[model samples]
Target: MYDSILVPTDGSEGAEAAARHGLNLATAFDSQIHFLSVVDERSYSSALADLDPTVGEQREGFEQQATEAVECLEEMVTEPPVTCQTAVKHGVPHEEIRSYAADHDIDLISMGTQGRTGLDRLLLGSVTERVVRTSDVPVLTTRHEPDRSRYDRILIPTDGSEAATAAIAHGVAIADRFDSTVHALSVVDVGGVVGAYDAGPGIPELIDSLEEECEQAVTVVEEECENRDIDIVTEVVQGPPYRAIQEYVDREGIDFVSMGTHGRTGLERYLIGSVTERTVRTSDVPVLTVR
Candidate 1:
């Protein structure tokens, strides 16, 4: 699993946190890691616009800066049981990174996020968010410092949908590699109950029905874990889907989160982005989004 992990760094502290996590994963799996620092042409255009240099001179310096950043990142990486490769490219960061992953056949993409940045106003998605949309492989991303307790437990969030099931296979592979426990959770979307709204006399029946549905959902997860030797914990929470997940992570002390993208295409992308973006934007632990 993850024979070659690719990490895109922008020399930000958030990226530094993710780089360290990528290194640790490489160490665990004895798999190679690639550290790529792409210098976006847009950033260059903004910074060097007033330099008053010839176009060729600007390109030379941009290329040189990209090279130097990659070298600096390489020097910062101290631990590696697996081989590490470093390179830099010039172009739109997201598109260029996606193409690099495609050309190199990267197994998994590891990236860092700023946690608060959602979709950019101009672009449909954030750069980190956009790659997850386009990447054909799994993506493991972290915005916060990784908890070093050694991934003793992983949390899998599912709606019992087809895409979520596909996500579990990738997550189980990670658990098997790390010898960790896997916990599965189903969140009932009870957001309608939240707010200053009023409920009728049938409220009790609605709650009862929702609870029963949650129980059935948890049962499915339990059955999936029954044949495995790894310890599995299952839970069902009632609230907005995102709120339930965020609360569970804090309540259960989850080390990492494994989630599925509906693999929504065309118009559905806006929908898929809502769930994943909220999770990545809020989760304190690492998140692996499987498509």
Candidate 2:
């Protein structure tokens, strides 16, 4: 379903890993691939130039690095059937990426969750986070080398919101392509509920109600998979959503994860706290997020 894929690089180990995964997807879909490297103009602005005499040289060096980054990604495309292109832009990294995707009608934007300069393990890379939060298109992110290009088992975490529905469609499409088993999971977020309000006599009934809601949430995903004749396993689990998802991935040997950037709010906002962000930051495999 991905006709055009975009891989934004910074010549980092993390970016290289993400590019390799993007190349794998392009091969599977026969999709055209575009590699983009952006030089942050803020690094060489006039204010910095006023303090440093070598600002001109720094700008040129940044431009060259950006050019080389995309060139490296372009070299990764060895398959003759997959078309590839490259470009370098001077702007904020995330903005340049978003503009390029929109301008080129990119079907997917895949990149590293961490940039060349590693980010804090607890936080997503700032640029990558900005792109994920703002981009209209789906973004796929990975922080480490991918073990295998093909996704044999895909996990879809849902919270029964419009955002979750969008994620389901993308996840199912990819699973259909790879003939992968789909795992549909919904978390009861007991921790969040107890933290937000008083845990009194009504807590048991509340948990039961939340579990039932979780079941219904995953059932929608089950129905969608059934329509496509795809094998799906559905479950409703109780815990912190992101932790539950990570546990599920490990227990099931899931190779990929797809979920929404946002979901239902309030006590049912199991998919909030940017659960997608937390998952993207910590997942061993690539996480594809749809808005």
Best by TM-score: 2
Candidate 2, residues 155-197: lDDT per residue as tens digits? 9999888899899999999999899999999999998889977
lDDT of 1 at 243: 76
What TM-score would candidate 1 get against the native?
A: 0.81
User: Tens digits of per-residue lDDT for model 1 on 1-291?
Assistant: 777888787666666677777777788788788888765566445465566467546666666755665676677557657788888777787887788888887888888875223221111227778877677888777877675727878888876666677777776667776787888877655455433236677666666666675566556656666656567888777666677778888988888888887633431121145777788776789888888
Which residue window of length 10 is worst by lDDT in model 1? 115-124
- Flag clash pairs in model 1: none
lDDT: worst 10-residue window of model 2? 115-124
lDDT value for model 1? 0.70
Q: Estimate each model's TM-score.
A: 0.81, 0.93
